[model samples]
Target: MLQRRRLLLLLSAAGCAQRPREPSEAAAAPLPAGISCVPFARALSGIALAGDAHLWWHAAAPRYRRGTVPVPGAVLVFRRSARLPQGHLAVVVRTVGPREIRVTHANWASGSARGQVAEDQSVVDVSPRNDWSSVRVWHPASGTLGVTVFPAWGFILPPRPADPAELAARVPVAARLAAGTL
Candidate 1:
């Protein structure tokens, strides 16, 4: 009986040794399936926006902030109206990967080089050092969609916004595209 108990205790110790570590200690860790939009973006980008300025910073710049905002990069979309995506605010979320993140605000947007203001601001990237905080994103190649972030001046009429459900619905859509490749 003593020998059996010793073996059982030894097995328990070995099992405990295989336990996973905390997330904070695992920066750049490969995410589990279906993580939130932000962590998904950071892992792909290789670089994330970083700073303590009460504002946003984008690494994946999108072309427009209106319509169905594109994906898999950082960008800003602005608006001055209250129409169905006609004039609104949002941040294009994405990274080097082929996914999209769409976060918008009625009166908030910030940047690293720019200051904060209230004009339905959207588009901002958080520092990767921030552990993907403010890192906007959607899904990856799992969905057949892509977007290109661009300079604010050359805003394009964005596609329609795909509800989280619709994006997950698996409609036949394009896979990869450039900023103007629309």
Candidate 2:
């Protein structure tokens, strides 16, 4: 009886040791005040891709693979235009469907103080060609999708970590985000 109880306690302790750490400790650290979208998305994805948000698309070409589809942890890079002089960056939270995805980004809420971060917001691809070349982001302040369809450079799937299998076995995004890690 004593041996059986000892074995059971050991097993429980081992299981507890394998539990994942909270995002606040293991995930990206919180952004500093007045930081732009580029660093925010980079930190959120645990990726090292750098440069201005508008230039990430071109900069990532040699270092990371670019794609048109959004993946859960990929950074969506927006193109620079007259309205958006510097461009934008957001992390894809999930794929809502064909031509639609949910994202989390910082400093996007208009007229709100600077460096406002919105989580799990909606973005719809509106490119006429069925590609993710253009999108309309959910405007939190306006309470509606923005009338302007912003052009995107494309989605940049960040380089996978050294341990791909470990990433596959990690906790789901929703749970992490709810835990404030993502």
Candidate 3:
């Protein structure tokens, strides 16, 4: 039965009438304001997705302010670039929210909210209704950390599994809670 359900989910995601579930619909909790992405990444990592040591979040950066009151399960996404404070981007891991997300960015020393055009800490309201998926079945989705960002980055990629079926089993949870289920 479990295998059948997983297979169905995979099919629904990749094919079939069931459209791919949006990333926002998979969250099972409400996000509060001031819930920065850095902390969100730190909190969501390992818990929401699989274990990831690369997604590190720090409070009070040597340059920027860390997550003062971040919630668990938020995604710390940013523009794939070299600078941190300037193009820092991320998503709030909630039970329910928007089908798609838009981001705004600026540099660190000049990233003032004066224009009232907040970038990283903007638009965290409850999501509207949509046909988006309630759960996201991802095995290992890592952020961009290529040479564009890391000057001399070098890390060994994981080996392919001998048993593809078993490897698929190692992926994250399939049945994500409905928005607000958390």
Candidate 4:
């Protein structure tokens, strides 16, 4: 009985040892099947924008703050291209550095991992100006930064105001006057 208990404990310990030790490692683990990146990013970031991921940047202009900076809870918008005709979106999980960020997104991988959510994946800014106009996403299958440089439209931040009225009220007097709303 004592030997059986010892063996059981060792087996459990071995199982635990196989678990990912860090968020990046966990990001490499395959998740269950998921929807496309648009819905996933919308739900995760609470941005509420719709349509193709490429359209999100312009669509967010009136409803949310859009910028080149990456912030937690913001949705990074990729541009439409030959490879990604509809583009892509990823919710910023954390800023790793001036040129690197960790994101949670979906549908970035191919094969069995395609359309599945990936969390804490690394994204590095590869643009020459460091403005986040282009980026290299981490490829879990290859366990490295992807070689293809994807163009990005920047990030759409969660709306600060609860309603349109509040947002209009918060707008600067100069800007509102210039736009002839004041």
Could you estimate the TM-score for every candidate? 0.18, 0.69, 0.21, 0.71
| Model 1 error, position 23 (Å) | 23
Between prediction 1 and prediction 4, the one with superior TM-score is 4
How far in Å is the alpha carbon of 99 misplaced in model 3? 18
- Of 2 and 3, the candidate ranking higher by lDDT: 2
- As for candidate 4, its clashing pairs are none
- Models ranked on TM-score: 4, 2, 3, 1
Q: lDDT values of the candidates?
A: 0.24, 0.61, 0.24, 0.65
**How do the residues 1-182 of candidate 4 rate in per-residue lDDT, one tens digit apiece?**
68645533432221100011112444323334434676556555667767777888898888888988887777888898887788888778778899998777666777665445667788999999998999998877778888989999998987641332332222233122212223
User: Deviation in angstroms for 92 in model 2?
Assistant: 0.4
Best by TM-score: 4
- Give one clash count per candidate, in the order shown: 29, 0, 14, 0
Candidate 4 error regions (>4 Å): 1-32, 160-182
Candidate 1 lDDT score at position 175: 10
lDDT of 3 by residue, 1-182 (tens): 68656533432322111111122232234223222222222222322221221222222123232331223223333322333322232333222234332222111112221111122222222213232211121211122211222111111111211232332222122122111112
